[model samples]
Target: MRKLQFIILLQFSILLFAQENEMKWQEKQYPDSLEAVNKAPENHIILFENENLRLLKIFVAAQKSEPIHSHRWPAVMWVYQPSDYEQVFYTENEKAERIPVQTVAMKKNELPMNVGFPVGKGDLGLSKNLGNQDLVAYRLDFKKKIDSSKKITKPTGWTWNEDLDGVKKAPASHQIVFEDEYTRILHVVLSKGEEESVHTHQNPCLFWVVKSQPIEYSEFKMDKKGKLRKSKTHQLPPLPTDQLLDQNKISDPEPPHSVKNLGTENFEAYRIEFKK
Candidate 1:
């Protein structure tokens, strides 16, 4: 009877340990928690966090798995390196299931191969890298809940013509990755010494540097013959600013500008424009 009782106690201990490991994130009791990222900085690094949003850089090595975590905000994820992975979601009842997340390449002028998902409050999941290369990505989580009923306002002093001549043409390096009523995300890649076409950003915008490199920012001025000419250039830093820019903060109405890569390697970035 003593040996049987000891065996039962050992089994109960194993069950308790398993339960503790599985529901580590749910026990925290906070919907807006980032405990997993706090615990593992190597895999999940917070680049910037403010009242409006939180930006994170995440890297998962090949064949590795991340701890179960929870996200309570709507997020936009930009993929730098594509890799196969499986995402396992946990429920309130401790039930779990794995779902395959595949990477699909987009068209040249369309959105990049990334993900934009609305993670309802207290959503919990874990991801496992199944490919040989590391999975690298940037996540932008909006702190405030979005209201879909509200319409995004257009930029002042500018019309909504997409085919305007002179400053409205997008450069070859610019690709629209993801867009919604509130925002538009662009993926831009410029080779060394390459210059983008003159363009105008009517709305407020911010960009994230995926490949850090020097770049020159220049404005377009109308010449005597009604042609656009590049003005004096200003050197932008190799890194992007963590803060978001809105219409009230940006300089000049109907600003027309272009970018030139100043580094030896390719300059890669994600431009996020606020529509409202």
Candidate 2:
């Protein structure tokens, strides 16, 4: 009876060891299914997606470290275990470089998060080398889908206190028509021989000519590196009212300049600037 009991205990120990070793891997696996291959003993939380910008999350127990593999997507990661020390290395145009060191120390037990922009197609492989202890992390992938409609409805700017006018006039000249907290969006209307009131943007802005008949225009402009600098003006030919304004045609840093309509009918345009 004693011998049989000892044999049973030994068998149990062997099975547990085998299970632990099976969890460790040093090679990558290319599974056909579009899902994360997780085997670590730690609490793994993964957010991944396919060709579309949809998101996913996964968690699993893990043991030993695994060999790295290629992951080509914009991602944000949070390291939940071990020391807060984290790092990323990559290749750009065939040249390899490790991301800048995050000197900021993480709180004890606090998760570390990282956001990666688009990377070169040639960049390949990612791995996490753990120390003596088990590894744990939570990765969040943000792959926002591009909306073409946003391209059309992108706001230009806000209407300023002075942009609204008490008088009605139509001709070809320069004018200041709109202002708002949003720096990148602008709504400006132009009339012949009109002059804009002196003002300052303090930030970048855009212009879209919505309506222009015989639409001669002044070049848009912005101040120099210095703030409160006066804006200079440039003259431009009239744009047709039937066509949509092409944003790419205008030069940037186009601010502070006054507009002058050089046409028989009124000219209207919108501008949008990006924020930091």
Candidate 2, residues 75-149: lDDT per residue as tens digits? 323232344322232222323333321122232344222211122211223334334344444333324534434
Evaluate model 2: give its TM-score: 0.27
Against the true structure, candidate 1 reaches a TM-score of 0.66
Candidate 1 lDDT over 178-226, as tens digits, reads 6778877777789999988777765556655677678898976778997
Estimate TM-scores for all models: 0.66, 0.27
Candidate 2 wrongly placed segments (more than 4 Å): 1-184, 198-200, 213-234, 240-251
Total residue pair clashes for candidate 1: 2
Best by TM-score: 1
* Model 1, C-alpha of 58: deviation from truth (Å): 2.2
Best-fitting candidate, measured by lDDT?
A: 1
